[model samples]
Target: MNCKQLQKIENYHEGKLQTEELNFVKKHLESCDECRRYLDELKSQALLLSRIKNFKPTLINPVAFRNEVLDQIQSKRNRYLVVRASRFVNSIIFILTQPITRYSFITAAIVIFGVFIFQQTIIVRKIESLEKRMGSNIVAKESGRPGRKNVDAFFKGRMEVQSDSDEAFRELLGNYRSLQIRYTVLLKMLKEKYPATYQEILKELEEAELLPENINI
Candidate 1:
């Protein structure tokens, strides 16, 4: 309430007040609810700061550590779920340092490697079996086809082409389609930038039946 009382309160906050001054302020605060509230607020704030200053971090659940160690020991452990390791930096190292943990990790790794090698061996055997089956089937199919004619001068040293006209036409059509696409692209560019060249190539393609006569660009 008074200037002297307020000065004493400030001195109390600063902690530089004499014993006599402290005793006087304590007496004044007993009769004054406002100063008492003010001191309580200050004490609460100081208590909070003191708690912060002397804070002791809590440990993670021991069950979680045990579960994490078990996860690492298992061969089929999830690589993404590293929940406990992130909390404690040396958890993995601590787990690995123990003789049991070391043996478990090595055993798990060996089991994983063995399974991988077993899978690879199975795959290699399957591939070899497939290759053998394919080779036998190919030989059987090849032997079923017509045999080659005489190599003598019976037909003026000319033997018939093994591939028929239909096969030849299909092959020719496939090659022509690729050539047609390239020529089409070139014709488009020529049509815009060089009209005479475009007309010549277009005429050649149409006459060769590579493109339809009435086809739109």
Candidate 2:
């Protein structure tokens, strides 16, 4: 077992584990020699610690001690609050102004891309709906059913719909291909220039169990 798992054993043996969890830990300790040893070491430590006598405070001057602590606490609070407030003010200013400057350009780019994607999706949906409607109408007219439109008009509409569907597909393919290229370049630059930060990201991913156990880096 790892250190964290061993720590949990002490928590479990001390009756701190919840009901369902206690049962699982009990069952695990029965079969896991590593965990059993860890629990034994913790038990030994607790036994040794319990035999030691506690020291009583001899200062007796409660007011002086309290005043000193209060002074130190106030100094720390002032430092912490000033730093925190400065950061908070800076972040607020950036939020209010950066969008109109740096982020306006990014927003415009995203909007342009989003408009293309939205158009593609709408066109695709419309094409599907139109195809179904036209197919049903064709079948009805062919099977001796009434309420059929002019054949010339129907053919012209079908051609226009087919052309639009093909154009939408082409546009979507081009847009996604460009997005992938841009993302790949950005990721490559980030990984190369900020390798330590990238490794930290990878470590977080490993802790989340996203990385495989055999992964080297």
Candidate 3:
């Protein structure tokens, strides 16, 4: 019959309490006069509230209220699905394109490599031919030198021939070195002048072994 028990008056009148709770409040109200009077007043107020008319126009429509709530929920769900589907499609496209992209890159690399090898082959062959021709020309010149051969002159001619061969070797070696240097310099220049040509020539030099393998920069 305490004031705390009176708090259940609303729930009891509305029939919202569990059976045991309702019985407890009812029993307390029966035993306590103050609690019984308080419960009566609460009942009277609830009955008056139920009979009161407070409805107004232009403020609420139940159909529109339900539709607005449903539309908002439906819109959120549709947007979520669209975002998820877009991400899925983008991922699938990327996966499908990965192998094709890799294969195209590999094909380009192979083509460039082949062209470089062919050019280097041509350059090396031309240089070797030039070296042989130059050697023959040098030998011919020495053989034509005025020597009337006596015992002393014969030995001297032999010495001259050796010297000529030595000169040919030196000259040819020097020309080879010079050509390699010039090729390097031209490659650098071409990189600034024509990048495409420089790339092709660089590939040739690599395959031809025209320069030391470690000679970068």
Candidate 4:
């Protein structure tokens, strides 16, 4: 059959065609097996759809259904969070309660204390060595001078004679300035790290007139 005649089969089966067009498609289908098969397939599809349309769906409130799903999801999330929090707390408590943890903490503290003591000891030794060297130099230079009345006289004579040479005096001044810079830097670090000790040192320096009374650190 022609495409136009085949296309009218659906209209014929659905009773949408005029009486004359219906009769024409009916005659064409009888003569053409392809058109007859197409009409049968279309009728079967329509019948299946009609049966599906006849079914009545069970109704539900969409808002309530959506709220119920959301509530379930929120409840699950809350339970998960609670479980995770509980696990974290339990783990912390477990570690804190363990004998090994306590021992480790004590060991760390002891090690830190020992390190601090060792550092202080080294610094004290260095200071003492520097002082001894300076004293020995002054003593050796004054060995020829008899009747050195006291330590003050010896130091005064040494200081007076040491500046006789311009080059040597300049070198001494340079070393003194360098030492002063280093001391200032160290003092600044100590002020930040140990405020109490720094305060005591500052007070001593101010009393001795080594540091200005109005200086903060």
Candidate 5:
């Protein structure tokens, strides 16, 4: 028998060969001494291996094992995603915390503040300029305007008129009791139209010892 035909010693011993192949190995083993010994060694080895027990634990919970494997895979995937997110956040923080970036933000804020102050100052200056122009124009118009001699004459006569009014007021105050007695209807109308003012006038008259007891108001 050839090497290929002799190699079927294990198959023949294990009953793995077809009927034709089984007959081929069987006849070859009986005829060839080397292939017969090889077949015998294979049988001895099989018997020894079958007799020995496996020391490792047997897999009884396939479903639990599959879940545990999936859990580990998911946990690793989550860890990878977390690591990627952490790296992205760290990159952003690092960029923002950089001296140039921090200073740029500060400079931008200062420039905006300066622009606002400048705009406010310009507005104030414009308002002040308008006020100054208005004052100057008012002064120039007043300087060019002519004075009224009649108004000056009225002012000059006002002191004399004020003295005469003071004398008249004193006389009227002296006759206030008689005036109240004579104009009883007018006093009631004044009280009705201006209650607070009438009360104040009555209070003043009392303070001056001019109000009479017969004057009800």
Candidate 6:
């Protein structure tokens, strides 16, 4: 039979076709056993579907489900945060308590402090030497004594011709004043650190007439 006649079998079985169409499909089915079998199979499938029990779908609360999922996510995040915080605190404790770490830190601090003290001592000694030279110069200048011939040769020659002697002299005096200030600071530090040594040095300078007796050391 033709496919159109075969397709009309379900409509014919349901009494949904006009009399003329029904007669045509019936005539075709009488000659075509395949179309009759197709119609019988469709009827059997329909009867099986009708016999099955219908069940209502179970409903879900979207808000409740969303809240449950969010709670799980928040719990995971909290656990991660706690673990990270614990590791950070443990690292700090380890650094503070480790013998190697403690020793290294202490050694570095001691070295830095020692270097600072050594530098200060060197500065003080240099200032002390400069003070002695400046005092000798002052004594020579006041006594109208000539300075070293070698040292004066260069300046004396320039002074005789350049007319820059006064400026040069002022520059030299300014430098002497700056050295005096440095010496005073170092002297105060020395006195504070070693008063007996400072007093002995002062008395020696006085006896040698390098430092005036009236000046407080």
The candidate that wins on TM-score is 4
RMSD of each: 21.7, 34.8, 18.4, 10.1, 19.3, 13.6
Rank by lDDT, descending? 6, 4, 3, 5, 2, 1
What are the per-residue Cα lDDT tens digits for candidate 1 across 1-217? 4445766676798798889988989888889887877777888898999999899887679889889888777734444346455647677677878999989989999999999999768755553443334323322233333222221211122423233343453354354454434434545655775587567655654443444333357
The parts of candidate 5 lying over 4 Å away from their true place are 1-31, 39-59, 114-217
Give the per-residue lDDT of model 5 (tens digit) for 1-217.
4566555777777788999988877787777888877777888888888777545667899899999999999999999999999999999999998999999999999999999999768755553443334323322333332234322332233212222344444455345454444334434644775577457645654554434455564
Per-residue lDDT over 160-203 for candidate 6, one digit per residue giving the tens place of the 0 to 100 score: 22223544433444556554564465457658866876676566
TM-score: the better of candidates 2 and 6:
6
User: Which residues of candidate 4, in runs, are more than 4 Å off?
Assistant: 1-49, 53-59, 95-102, 116-175, 182-186, 200-208, 211-217
Candidate 2 clashing pairs, residues 3+ apart or interchain: none
Alpha-carbon shift of residue 164 in model 1 (angstroms): 11
Q: Point out the worst 10-residue segment of candidate 4 by lDDT.
A: 154-163
Question: Candidates' TM-scores?
Answer: 0.28, 0.27, 0.26, 0.44, 0.32, 0.36
Worst 10 residues of 5 by lDDT: 154-163
Question: What is candidate 1's TM-score against the reference?
Answer: 0.28
**lDDT, model 4:** 0.63
Model 3, position 69, has a per-residue lDDT of: 91
The CA root-mean-square deviation of candidate 4, after full C-alpha superposition on the true structure, stands at: 10.1
The total of clashing pairs for model 6 equals: 0
Against the hidden true structure, what lDDT does model 1 obtain? 0.57
For model 3, residues 39-150, the per-residue Cα lDDT tens digits are 7888888777767745334646889999999999999999999999999999988975898877987898999999998877776555444333433443334454432232
**Which of the two candidates, 1 or 4, achieves a greater lDDT against the reference?**
4
lDDT of 2 at 38: 86
Once fitted onto the true fold, the runs of candidate 2 whose alpha carbons sit more than 4 angstroms away are 1-62, 95-113, 116-217
Q: What are the per-residue Cα lDDT tens digits for candidate 4 across 57-88?
A: 87478889889999999999999999999999
